[model samples]
Target: MMFRLESVDARQYRHKSKRVGWTMAALLLVFGLAFSQLLVQSFGSSFWLNALGVLLGLLATSLIFAWWRRRPDMAEVRYVTRLKQHLARVSAHLSTLRQASRQGDVRALDLLAFYHQGMAQLETLEGRTMDDDAERLAERLELRKQRQLHGLPEEVAGFDPAELDAFRRSEPRT
Candidate 1:
């Protein structure tokens, strides 16, 4: 199956959030700093100092917030979030999927995808990126594709306990 970083942290969802945050902060700061521009333009007051202050404040606040992201321990937070999502993904179907995997059923690929993503999430929490196991699996899959999966079902609409178990009972149980 084609997969890439299926297990990413909740933070990945917030990737564009930082830009939005910066834009909002800049807007708020700029609104406040507008007073300086007003002073400079209308009153002919010496607002150069205020202009510098506004510039400095914007840059400094941006840098400070960026650095603060490193201060808190978000490892557990991200892990818990990922765990919840994974649970939601496989909670009802986990056992059936496992049985499917043990039976060498093509439906097992869905199970593998779930685990592959979970591992990736764990790796991310550890300051790691890619799942090496997944890399190897992908490589093997690529090599195996030429041979083709000899007996995949014509239509796999994902796993269901009843559907998978019906076939599981027919297997030799080796």
Candidate 2:
């Protein structure tokens, strides 16, 4: 099941898997109460023992539910932090790629490898960003892909203005 990690201000929030699990869990309380009632009737004991057992059962169920609810919140924070760190690492690797590509040496192959890795990481991060940030930098990434495509051609010859124009158009404005 897809779980949405919602953010409140800068903090994170997560749905507690709805009340379905809670309802199922409450069955433990129901069974305990029924068992307790049966025991009270069969043993001719005072009502307090059965009542206490039922109360303890309810308390245990409540603690389990509370723990289950907080679980996703903890997981959400970890997931977000890991994503942010991954993005940072990808960005740093891309910078190294740009530098190596500038040198125009055999190391360009290494840069290409890094570029491909960075693109994969960027793709993953794109899915996890805030709504308004979903498509951020995607256009630039497409332009980068187009530039790589153009660079693959061995023939440039004289500077054709049309080809230059097309290349310029494919690149990010800034």
lDDT score, residue 14, model 1? Answer: 49
Candidate 1, residue 107: CA error in Å?
1.5
Q: What's the count of clashing pairs in each model shown?
A: 0, 0
lDDT of 1 by residue, 99-171 (tens): 5555556545544444544544555554566645775567336323422454443222322444434545554
Q: What is the C-alpha RMSD of each candidate to the true structure, in Å?
A: 14.4, 16.9
Query: How high a TM-score does candidate 1 get?
Result: 0.28
lDDT of 2: 0.46
Residue 152, model 2: lDDT of: 45
Number of the predicted model whose lDDT against the real structure is largest: 1
User: Once model 1 is optimally superposed onto the true structure by TM-score, how far is the C-alpha of residue 21 displaced, in angstroms?
Assistant: 30
**Residue 24 in candidate 2 has what lDDT?**
48
Taking the tens digit of each residue's C-alpha lDDT, what string does model 2 give over 1-174?
211222322322223223435564776668568767777788767778687667767776777655764575555435444445543543554544454445443233233433344344434443444325545355345435544654643211112224323433443443
Point out where model 2 deviates above 4 Å: 1-25, 34-45, 73-174
Off by over 4 Å in 1: 1-104, 129-135, 138-172
